[model samples]
Target: MNLHETTVVLVAAKTATLAFGSALTYLSYSAFRRTDSRALRALTIGIALLTLGVLLGGVLHQFADITLEASVSVQSVFTAVGFAVMTYSLFVDIIDEPDRTRSGARTGD
Candidate 1:
């Protein structure tokens, strides 16, 4: 549609993204707390970074007099870093406990 309509749609979409991202970050943080696992902690941080990127981008565009492209660039940087951290978390070892079999039996290393 027109420019104003498009801007409104973008704002709404960004707000929704922020809301959903916040919920996801909270869930990840809760999971990390329950397990006390380093990987889970990293995952939580990654999720937070992603959510923060959206927030920062919005603020920059709306209040910092930054160009839309620049704001999006900042968001992209955070997203990339967040994904990298998540990937690293996958390679991290689990808690320092004996390995468990599928049936929940502890196995010797």
Candidate 2:
């Protein structure tokens, strides 16, 4: 494909990524609000960071005229940090639900 075609495809892919990331972030935030769980809050933040990485990377590369390598580096850092938070959210017992079991079954409601 030519340069124009490649650019179009890249932009389209980035747009789709942004849309899906935004939806995921919204859903995560809603869940966090409903449950008031610290883990959920962390998850929401992680998702938001991941989405921001995509946006910033695209904008830096396309609009700011930054090098592709620099943009990708920025994106990678965000992605790594986001995944770390997400992993922490999964492994740490940030919730204070005393009635909840290890199997995730609520002992009382």
TM-score of every model versus the real structure = 0.82, 0.84
Give the 10-residue window scoring lowest on summed lDDT in candidate 1: 93-102
- For all candidates in order, the CA lDDT equals 0.87, 0.89
Which residue pairs of candidate 2 clash?
A: none
| lDDT (tens digit, per residue) of candidate 2 on 6-85 | 98998999899999999999999999999998888889989889999999999899899999999999998999999999
Kindly report which residue stretches of model 2 are placed more than 4 angstroms away from their true locations once superposed. Answer: 94-101, 104-109
Backbone clash numbers for all candidates listed: 0, 0
What's every prediction's RMSD, in angstroms? 3.2, 3.2
Q: Write the per-residue lDDT of candidate 1 for residues 55-100, one digit (tens) a residue.
A: 9999999999999999999999999998998886765664343363
Model 1 Cα RMSD, 1 decimal: 3.2
